[model samples]
Target: MGKPPLSGIRVVEFAGIGPGPFAGMMLADHGAEVIRIDRTRPGGLSLAIDAKDPLLRSRRSVSLDLKNPDAIAAVRRIVRDADAIIEGFRPGVMERLGLGPDVLLGDNPRLVYGRMTGWGQTGPRAHEPGHDINYVALSGVLHALGRAGEKPTPPINLAGDFGGGAMFLAFGMLAALLHAQRTGEGQVVDAAMTEGSSVLMSMMWGFRAMGRWRDERGTNLLDTAAHFYDTYETSDGKYVSLGAIEPQFYAEFRRVAGLDDAKWDRQMDQGGWPALKDELTALFRTRSRDEWVALFEGHDICFAPVLGFDEARADPHNVARGAFVEAGGVSQPAPAPRYSVSDTVVPQMAGARDDAGLLRELGFGDAEIAALGH
Candidate 1:
């Protein structure tokens, strides 16, 4: 295999929480030399085992006190040779630290400056503090989730923090890198979780416009309202999901499940969904989840048994594909979207490093390194 696609690319990530580290992890996994500049004092929303945190994998760390001018100068020196920089702070925070886009981009015109935030750089709530739930709530995602006549359930932090925030930040930085390569002009990527999450609901918005989706939560086809498209609990107290939306697939599902009632004929009859769903709920409880899985093993009914984290890691298909790997004494997902030619680097644990040695490699003389107290 060839060298990784981003073998020579350098990314400087200002350490923050959530989406910033996740974006850095993606770039590092794909073979970018991601250097994370962490705070000299450690106090933030960090896990107890930060060294084994999957989001911080495949990167090196450099702790620096941003309040010190010498540390700021060192960061500027580092940014001068970097292709991109990622920062996840509220508006003007970087400027306060003297590491804003204007200063860095003025020095390196080819740099891609990526900014991650809950609200965008400019908005009514841009400077306000918030988290994943607030961002998704503002984006109409939270309002559309959960069961009928129930409160909206938060999908943890996936939809807002990682899916909307980190993924878009990574994509924007890569796109801006391409543009910088072509024009030699650096630009800032203002990636906001609110806007990104809103974009994720584009299909739902279109469905609403086309009169295919209802305003009520959990009333849509993809939600939990459809009798043929939902999860059911089994006798073993485990769950299995069914998404047999197509006519042929639904028919196959009914045939396999032994549903000979004439009422199962109309699959899309929303008015009869509640009663049909209750019937399915009662029917599924008659057998164990694994028994249902065995019965549907060779079928195309869009069925899958819901598995927990450990079960997912130990699944046969996951084992065959090497989807999860053991690294740093922890089981975690492997780098995704494989490349035929370029190689992906194995993830490593994040921990303390030789700061002086790294500085020397960056062309800092022994005296200057000592002066910076590295």
Candidate 2:
């Protein structure tokens, strides 16, 4: 394994679902030693269709019930030397489990305690059971998706779950870690998916304030208001994306599609979007997604194929950049945002280390190990 950027930073993950594991994965990607504290039971919820569960990448897992006295003591020992710890659970679940930050942070003042949840740490919906779609729904992002006059389609949990949820938690934890390293003081990060999802829509909020964004869902420029900034299907049932947002790009797009001058000049004026979209749709239908991909490969036309996970992994750009790495016969996204001179190893899948290894990595010694034996 190549040395990763987060090589020496040890992270403990109290696994929950969705964003929690994903945040852990991000830390692992950055080269942190992330050990997931998992229960023996896979529990009630599981979404393991992608074999290795892409979100579960870049971490080691350990199965233990913290209810046990020995296990609880073991965790305290781990936290005492740990840099950061993240958990996704209801407000009092961790405290009920006897591993709350109040107790843990006191054990080590330098620990960055990150807590992630659906609604937030404090709210009417804090105790409610909801998922990404629910958070997006409440945050108004879900309503902004899909075509005009249609039911609000969920954007596959990107806004709430990962974008708002995992990404935000990871960001907060890392930010706090940096501060802790410099000041030798630890703090708690309360990350709420609803808040994060709403933060992700700041640009849209700005557009709304400027009266450029419409609330009618998918009726605005970026949300299918413009004919050029949308997706079109091909003869082969595949699809390609279009983003000819600029005048020059739209002109080039029309030129490529054999559009005449009069129709081409009607960019973003009047109700010409429907006509333009219909024309482009008809033109795109003439070829498969691949054909158009080749047609617009190097153009500023802002074109791209709507490739699926497998196709995405196989695409030349993804392949060339090593976007997906294969491990344990499963393909998953590689660690992101490459650095010039950092260790770059894909964290081994699942529990690739023993308890002793995890303990020592967190600064446990033989005496501490013997203490756990009691």
Q: Which stretches of candidate 2 lie over 4 Å from their true place?
A: 41-51, 351-374
Best candidate per TM-score, number?
1
The CA lDDT of each predicted structure is: 0.91, 0.82
Which residue runs of candidate 1 sit more than 4 Å off their true CA positions? Answer: 42-49
Q: Mark the 10 consecutive residues where model 1 has the least summed lDDT.
A: 40-49
- Candidate 2, residues 1-374, lDDT tens digits: the string is 35777889989998778899889888888888887876543442222223367677767665565656777877887778789999999998888888898899989999999999999888888999999999988988888888987888888878898999999999999899999989999999999999999999999999999988878986889887688899999999999998998889988887777777696687878388887788878988999888888888777888889999899999998999998889877788877888887856664665343655656665768786555431
Residue 89 in model 1: lDDT? 92
Positional deviation of 130 in candidate 1, in angstroms?
0.3
Model 2: per-residue Cα lDDT at residue 64: 60
Q: Number of backbone collisions per candidate, in order?
A: 0, 3
| lDDT per residue as tens, model 1, 137-215 | 9999999999999999999999899999999999999999999999999999999999999899999999999999998
TM-score list, all predictions: 0.97, 0.91
